[model samples]
Target: MSSSTPVWPAGHDRRVLAEVDSTNAEAARIAATLAGPTWILALRQTAGRGRRGRAWNDPPGNFAATLAIPSGAAPAQAALRSFVAALALADALTQATARPEAISLKWPNDVLLNGAKVAGILLETTGQGGTPGPLAIGIGVNLSHAPDPGTLEPEAKAPTSVLSATGAAIDPESFLDLLAPAFARWEATLRQHGFAPLRRAFLDRAARFGEPITARTLRETLTGTFTDIDETGALVLTTAKGPVAVQAADIFF
Candidate 1:
């Protein structure tokens, strides 16, 4: 699988391989049994997933990869793990387009490219032993062909593709090569330094903040303006009662 190329991240050992199982599924299964950052990157995924357990679109050559991490992370950090991956993905797309401003971070784990959904991050977890044991970050980037944007979900807004956005074709290998290492730095940063700086930057670059929107949390749906994103990645919404810090929510603009 190694071409005339540097591996993803350049130096980190890549356990790059294909699998029939969903990348998230494979990551969860092996998270406890495997070593660190063993990536399950496949050219095809039969049962891909997205936030809120939605069926994620799986087109060939698109990135369906996840990284297995060690077994010692705080619940709050673990709860907000996607932020690390989100930041990493933003950096990756920025490299591909050379337009960092064009790529923005969506709360939770979505990646917005030029205001459209270019990618998303999903985390799979298993009980290893600690606060949050086995953790795997599953990321999917629209690198190539896809269903017409018109067919996307009702809530899905301005959709786009890398090949379309940057006006250049992007190879999955090239994208990963650029993403993996950049991801490690952000991932490690979140693990060590909490998410204050990253959260701030993420909010600043966030496409939608302080705007009236709808959110579906574990509890129920709420319509409010996005007021703040706290350090723990909890979204603060100006709800009817007052300001509520959201732990997890499926947001809609």
Candidate 2:
């Protein structure tokens, strides 16, 4: 970390690129060579992707970054970092805009501002020589621009930018300064305590809790009351059938 303007977190590496194909791709290419956790930020991404292979519309002023952490945890445990990243993202958004009340987290890695989509998270693992690899936490924020709603898939949340939503014109680098440290703090909490604390924290900021929401999986779509997140970070929905725990799905509200 650099001790310069926009004070960065200590014990972590930060690399800011003028442009890249994608921060997650860059992180995967450099994951094996890193000696410690590193944050990779790309001011512009020519080829960015979102969950389910959707294109990420990263305008020049928006945020595109990934935190590459060397990890040895099991795949299930590693996947839980999405929640960890979500908590950090919420914290950073609250700090940046000074509107904590406006920030809320959507399930399965989406951040909402004023009940609209403002940011998203994607997780991938990179390994070499059959050993456990680094976990890349890719985050994209609509800092200054958002994609047109017509381009979105059906039932996808409408997108909104920080500048438009709250009149906060935060640039990518300055936003990274806020995100990296906040992520570090939550990472420490996950390492020290467990998913219990993170689950509680995520639920506190969770959007649409106790409300009707629909989760779409590959096989079927399940609509139920958003009740809780379980011990393993599964979304617990109280459907008419019963209490169903969903491990992976696209949640819509």
Candidate 3:
């Protein structure tokens, strides 16, 4: 991490838990009562989860936390914070490693270090009566350990850890100190300037940009050139037939 101390964002509450089933679940449970944005950190996450209902292996010494933010925007607008999270994540990793060139953001919600998967993000919102509620932005980083490759699905990118990749063994709380402020800055940028700037920033650090990759959805599989993220944050790719915008898919590179 940085040599200087990290400044926690103003007006944000932080809770460090010794153990929890999942930070996201806890965030969902307490979202309604939150007075302001809160960062929940779990030293030991027993039952963490990822996108598509996949089981996330969050060993001790890793980073597993969620930012619970109260919001009333439409799901689509609120969902755009994934980019905010990703950008913040990239910034934190770069700051920790001091090697900006090694940090890159993957499509959807992943962070790559030295071209391997090092972090992932999951977004969920709570609502009532069709009105959007608070949002939980769950983030996990392989700070000290990478799961066994055999445990992952076929064609999944190999996992790496901050310790392995950069020799920086960051404690969960120390990393959070770096992350929470970065997230606050990015969130402010999003609120003031909008997604255009964030999209451009993300694209600048996008992994496999202009590269050929495969996106697999429930109905079909598409292979195309990774192009741009649309206004609504959909993955835009140039396929053999034409350009396609994929709302949800498992991308394989």
Candidate 4:
């Protein structure tokens, strides 16, 4: 299939591929040589991946892309871009479907429509000698098709698609046209004000806050009331022990 061309901002390197092992991997390769805010897009990813090393099934026609950029903030603060990605995607989908109320963001970086997962964001960083390097932000949205319920991993949330949810036959390229600029806007907000306003906007569209939820971390599982994300973007859980700040975890609501 011929790749669709979308206009990108100046100084940005955007590459569209017919097939690849993973867009994130490709972006990482580019980051090694170029000090780029580069975007790598794949029409079909033979071996896509997600957070925590889970396989990301990428069928042709779905959105599979990664944006790699140099890090400007400390490691902890740079991680907040995941939230920026989530908010950008939510905005783009809301505009595409014309259903602002139907779209919402789950904690961390999952985008949902009417409580079903429509897209996911994965952020990976490369560095040398403990020094921060380029950051690759991977995003996969189910535009034309979603995985069958039975095919999803046990930990994965229920999945849906733009076609299924909105009855709109949106393609990956057309979706990028909406997503790229929306992402730029949020990135600019993060650069100017910091996470305070971004956190507020994230909470405004956040789903299932102040509810009982389970957070499965690498060490153990913690159940608590979902309270808020701290100033640095850590998940704040009101557990029996106290408010636990989680830097990374798989959340279940």
Q: Identify the candidate with maximal lDDT.
A: 3
For model 4, residues 2-61, the per-residue Cα lDDT tens digits are: 143335556667778999999889877777676558778899999999888888888888
Error of 2 at 180 (Å): 0.4
Best by TM-score: 3
Candidate 2, residues 162-197: lDDT per residue as tens digits? 999999878899899889888888889998999999
137, model 3: CA deviation in Å?
Answer: 0.3
Which 10 successive residues of model 4 have the least lDDT summed? 1-10
- Which residue runs of candidate 2 sit more than 4 Å off their true CA positions? 1-7, 127-131
How does residue 190 of candidate 2 score in lDDT? Answer: 91
lDDT of 1 by residue, 1-253 (tens): 1233334553354555555568878777666677556666777888888877887787886777877775646666676767777877877777777788788877877888778888988876775456567777788888886547666777776667887777656777677887787777877777588678778778877867878878887879988888899766788889889998878788888
The Cα local distance difference test for each model comes to 0.75, 0.90, 0.92, 0.85
Q: Which ten residues in a row have the lowest lDDT in candidate 2?
A: 1-10
TM-score of each: 0.88, 0.95, 0.98, 0.93
Residues 103-207, candidate 3: write the lDDT tens digits.
Answer: 999988999999999999999887889898888999999999999999999888899999999998789999999999999999899889989999999999999
Count of clashes, each model: 1, 0, 0, 0
- Give the C-alpha miss distance for residue 95 in model 2, angstroms: 0.9
